[model samples]
Target chain A: MSGYIEAGYISVFSVLTLYGGSLIIRVRKTEKKLPDLTEEKKD
Target chain B: MSEVNFAAIPQVFSKRAETATKIIGVLALLSLIATVWLGLFVTPPDQFMGNLVRLLYVHPPIAWVMFVAYGVAFLSTLLYLWPRTRDLRFDRLAGASSEVGVIFTGLTLLSGSIWGRPTWGTWWTWDPLLTTTALLFVMYLGYLALRRLPGDPETRAKRSAIGGLVAFIDVPIVYFSVLWWKSLHQAPTVLDPVTGKTYIHGSMAYTLLLGFVAFTLLYVYFVAKRYRLERLKYLYDRVLLDEAIQERKREAADFKAYGADKKSLVPTAFAENGPALGDARFFGTEEESVVGGGEAGR
Candidate 1:
């Protein structure tokens, strides 16, 4: 394939990565609350 | 729901949540890096398809994730709403699944449009496959809107459960819409019509697999995180409600005690003074004994 096609492929994957990474970061921030629920359940 | 029985939210998620999140993170990294190298440096351009074939990397995975999200919603709804096996946990699961479904469906349409514009020469088409998939997305959105309607949890659960189940029928129709109608959308391209081999080979196949795994992990993480948040909100609401009810009960008890004390004091005053005979005359009674008459009857 030509360099342009190769670049296009990278762009596609880059978009996927960006979208997926953003979601992961959001989840990490919220995960801190998860343990509070477990402790409450035990009590 | 009472305080004791209401589910608790966790400060840290369970193993599934942790694992799924990690996998999603790693896969996202790998997909980004690898696709950049592979698409930009490895894969060659097609003489006819040009750069358009690169879209295959994104479109297929987006469609798969969207379908998988709907599957999660359908399965959870069945487990949650079935009378004999009805489990409220599934309610959270269904909500989480639907949320992911909505996200991925939007992605599917976006990627599909990107692929269509260059190849089909239009951003939108009336093709049967595209039309049905669009319809499927809209129905689940309605399911979500209905879920947010005002009422108690139980009522919301029932309505959304029915909506989830009814919406499941659209999945199959969407899958087969191309077969059922003549359309401009390309027929299934994965199959080799002559050799029966998949069109994808080598690194392309591996990267596609990586994308699939990454999306699946991400979906799981989001759903679990959302479920935990929902459980916490539920517990918080129950605690507040319980406190309110207890406060009301205490107030009622105090009022009863105060009323009883007032009643006892009234008789004490009447009994102590014995209300002189003229007090009866105050009421125009003929005899002073009438004061005791009423108290004695009591």
Candidate 2:
């Protein structure tokens, strides 16, 4: 019973953390691209 | 000297929204940690399903969040399809929501399967709830594929928008699936549609509510990030296109100007003889002259 409960918690945490981490990575990548995107378009 | 306007494009997301989402994200993480601790250690296990019922803290909220994501995608697609309000921003939003929705939906399916294995004595069954969920997943998988299909931006957006709208039909069907048909799956856990009440009580209810809040905040954060990514890519594409168009215009202008100044057009050559019997005059003003070889100086 305890094993099943622990497994469920682990699964939920893994999914949430991975999804949140991906979002953070993408936001940073896009931020870096912003200035270059503006400069290139203007050029 | 060619002006190809790139001024119409808008930022996919504002800096303020990004910062706000980051704050919400931090709060959401704390909320999730607290909720998990409450459900796992504080709350008592169910008398019927034992500790297996702890899975409830996570699964139902995932279903709710998945619905919200798909709903956002559907509404964005609808806005994009309407002529008066049509814009690429809506299409980008639709794409962002679909991406996040697909991941959450997949998680929901997995969580349900794990829960079922212990409670229902099987990992999966062709129950109404399970069948409909599987169908929804496949349909959105097709929708995401359409987004990446090879086409002009307008064509791709139209296809993906239409695909998203079509796939959204499965959402309502999934929601009503358990009610409209017989199934092993239980009815709504929280917010009973008939009695207008919650099925869970006390500490259980608090944990469930926490799950919903955390999942929703995560969804919003991901959607904003993904939308900005799409917008930056869109802007980069427009820049490349404008640069290419300007280069072509410059080449054409230079050719026309050089031809006029040097008397380099061989207009009489075409009438005197056809292409087969043509002299150097056909390609240039005279023998060995270059027709489109740019201004004569480097």
How many residue pairs clash (N, CA or C atoms closer than 3 angstroms) in each of the candidate models, in the order given? 20, 0
TM-score of each: 0.73, 0.82
Worst 10 residues of 2 chain B by lDDT: B289-298
- Candidate achieving the largest TM-score: 2
RMSD of 2: 6.5
Show the lowest summed lDDT stretch of 10 residues, model 1 chain B.
B1-10
Model 2, TM vs. native: 0.82
Per-residue lDDT tens digits for candidate 1, residues A1-43, read: 4343344444544655565456556545554423344433446
Q: For each model in turn, which proportion of the native inter-chain contacts is also found?
A: 0.16, 0.46
lDDT of 2: 0.79
Error of 2 at B114 (Å): 0.8
Candidate 1's residue-wise lDDT over B1-298, tens digit each?
2333233222333555556656765665566566545644566555578766666665676677778888988988988777887877788788878877887777677777766767788878988888888888899999989888887788888889999998889998877676678888765556644456676667666666665665666566667656655665555656566667778999999888878876564566565655544555344554534445433321
**B82-138: candidate 2 lDDT, tens digit per residue:** 999889889999999998888888888888888888788898899998998999999
